[model samples]
Target: MGNKEQTFQKIIEIAYVMFAENGFEKTSLAMIATEVGISKPAIYYYFQSKDQLIAYIFDELYKEIQQDIAVDYKELTSANFKEKLLELGYKSIEAQGKDPYFNKIFNQYVLLAARDESYKSQLVELETSFLTSFVEVLQWGVRLGVLDDTPHIEAKAQMLALVYDNIGNFMLTGNQLNYRAIWKEAVHSVIQGGKDDK
Candidate 1:
């Protein structure tokens, strides 16, 4: 990367840590600049304000997490849909566990979204994208004649996404629950459309 791109990326990395450690309110541009060995104005050259920098951080983090857990949609089939979904769930948990600041940063963003429209909009878009992945997978299964095309696909996808989020939250908070089992059960239920075999 060029010097300017390197400096911009450095600023983002430093700012992310500071926000995760000190929070959005506590971390200032000056502090980030100091950590990055650049002038506060240098930060402005890349980001108009701390909020903008944080929004960028949120976008980048989301992309990284998505890439880490992404499944090959092109290769998806009915026989492997459940397995792929389980892998997605497990990989999501693994990715979150790999990043010590992920939960903290996510919580910070949640708090920011509570009062900031821009943050709220970005979060809504991110969540919509996540949900769309599940919906697309379900639709793909239906098209392949391997899974039922239930009318409640969207609702089911939403519930699955919620389960993943809660599982990550519980694990991060040291709740010590059987997350793998919980995740497997959740995936099974979604796949079965909440039916009871017995």
Candidate 2:
């Protein structure tokens, strides 16, 4: 990579660690520069502002997840519908758990967006892309008859959003509930009367 590319990547690496550890608000460019063994001005050469850095991280995370799902989609042709659905559930959990610090950054992002209309719109777009993948999986399940057809795919999307909210809550509160068991019960509740009895 060129020096510019290398420096840009280094900045992202430093920002990821700091944002993960200190969160977006608590993290500062000076701290990231200190960690990167570079001056603050050097950091500026790569990113104009901390918000940009945070946005970059969001983009990176989204791209990585979409790539992962694309790979999984290609391999699911032979898998049974139940197996694919379970795989998707597991993948969703794993995606949230990607970076140990991702949860903190994610929650902070949500809070920031809530207070700022512009940030809220950008955040909605980012989150929509992330959630859309799971929505697609759920739609696929319905198509395969593992999950019953809802009139619209969006109801399932809303259900998955609740699931995502649960993950964010687990990250924020460190609540000790048995999430696995809770999820199983919740999923059953959502689909109980809807499944085709064969």
Please report, in order, the local distance difference test score of every candidate based on alpha carbons: 0.80, 0.68
Candidate 1 global lDDT: 0.80
**Candidate 2 structure lDDT:** 0.68
lDDT of 2 at 45: 83
User: Which candidate should be chosen as best, given lDDT against the real structure?
Assistant: 1
- For model 1, residues 107-198, the per-residue Cα lDDT tens digits are 89889889989889987887787877777777777787756778987788788888988887887687878777888888887776533321
Model 2 scores worst on lDDT over the 10 consecutive residues at 189-198
Candidate 2 lDDT, tens digit per residue, 1-198? 998888788888878877876778788998989888889888888889988888888778767645755425555542354444544556666666655666676667678788889779976776676677667766666665656677866676667657755765684566765555555554555455544321
Question: Candidate 1: TM-score?
Answer: 0.80
Task: Note the clash tally of each candidate.
Answer: 0, 0
Model 1, position 79, has a per-residue lDDT of 63
TM-score for each predicted model, relative to the true structure: 0.80, 0.72
Off by over 4 Å in 2: 1-6, 65-79, 129-136, 150-157, 188-198
